[model samples]
Target: MADWLSPAEWDALRLSLRVSFWATLVSLPFGLLVAHALARWRFPGHGLLNGLVHLPLVLPPVVTGYLLLLTFGRRGWVGQWLDQWFGIVFAFRWTGAVLAAAIMAFPLMVRAIRLSVEAVDPRLEQAAGTLGASGPWVWATVTLPLILPGVIAGAVLAFAKAMGEFGATITFVSNIPGQTQTLPSAIYSFLQVPGGEAPAARLVVISVVVAMSALVASEWLARRAMRRVQGR
Candidate 1:
């Protein structure tokens, strides 16, 4: 793979994988919580929450990035407080790229998981509760297993989305070479200069391969999840 992609290209690819992995991992717990809430609960502000969750999909990537920058940048309020108290910085850094990718991929993950959650029968959980299982235990042993396929599918989709993320990442962290440059950013960078089409094409191929692999993996996992659900 190193020989296949140039050093810079390899860097971008590596960074993209790293960012996507961390982003997906970090988003999982939150995704599950939000998905369950959206799927099973009906609060007073349910519509508002749903709209807010899907807001990023309708908004331009640049606008989302700008908002992230304004809210999470070094000089931003949250950023300053974090920096002062926790020493965690997110502006123009790799972590910021992860945040951007996570946020960009979140809605898709939530939607997939929400659909799965909706498919589950509430009676199973109620039965578990009647059997003296705590809510969390019931969720862990019952609800979670039933929706494993959707969770896997959602996670893989988020990974693919994170891999392709460009606009928000670039806007939030800028193209700072190995520090913050992702696969899409590298491809964009390649396209900006003369005699860069070949490299850009190569990166595009890489992107397609990675995305396809994620999809294939998702399908396989979904099937496996079904098998488990069936006790096969």
Candidate 2:
């Protein structure tokens, strides 16, 4: 594998893994919070919040990327503030790629987690509360344990989705080599050049393997977590 790929290709592959890992890791906590809110909360604008959370799934990836660029571009509002105050800039950077991947992957992660949260028995949480457990404690000890399988599934799903993210990332970061060129972007770039099919094909195989492995791992982890919860 090392000999088959050029240094540039290897850089893209490594960067893709880094971007996907960060995207999944950074988004997991927010995904869990949003999933829990949608599953259990009945606050105002619930439907609106849910719709907003899922909008990326329905919207065109290009459009989502454009919106991200508009909001996070150097001259943009949030982008300017971050650059001025925090010395942070997302435009055309690897961090921008992470943001795009996370945004594109968010819906899948949230959906899987929401389903898992919904499947948990509410009575278990209520019983824990009756035993004098605080709300947070009950959630931490009982509700979270019951939904651990789903959470694992959701994280794996998000990670896989991030691995394949292209459109938004390209639009946001412009596919710079060794900087923001993820697997999909690298594959696309290779396709645009002469005699690039072989490299593209190699990356395609890697992408398929990574995606399938993630799915399999998700299933295995979920089952393990379920068994743990059942004390079996």
Name the best candidate (by lDDT): 1
| 84: Cα error in model 1, Å | 1.1
- For candidate 2, the TM-score is 0.97
The 0-to-1 C-alpha lDDT of every candidate, in the order given, reads 0.95, 0.93
> What is candidate 1's lDDT per residue for 45-98, written digit by digit as tens?
998988988987889999999999999999989999999999999998999999
Which regions of candidate 1 deviate over 4 angstroms? none
Give all TM-scores, in the order shown: 0.97, 0.97
* Span of 10 residues, lowest total lDDT, candidate 1: 1-10
Candidate 2 has which clashing residue pairs, if any? Answer: none
lDDT of 2: 0.93
lDDT of 2 by residue, 1-232 (tens): 4798989889988999999999999999999999999999999999999999999899999999999999999988999999999999999999999999999999999998999899988898889989999999998999889889989999999999999998889988898999999999999999999999999999999999999999999999999999999899
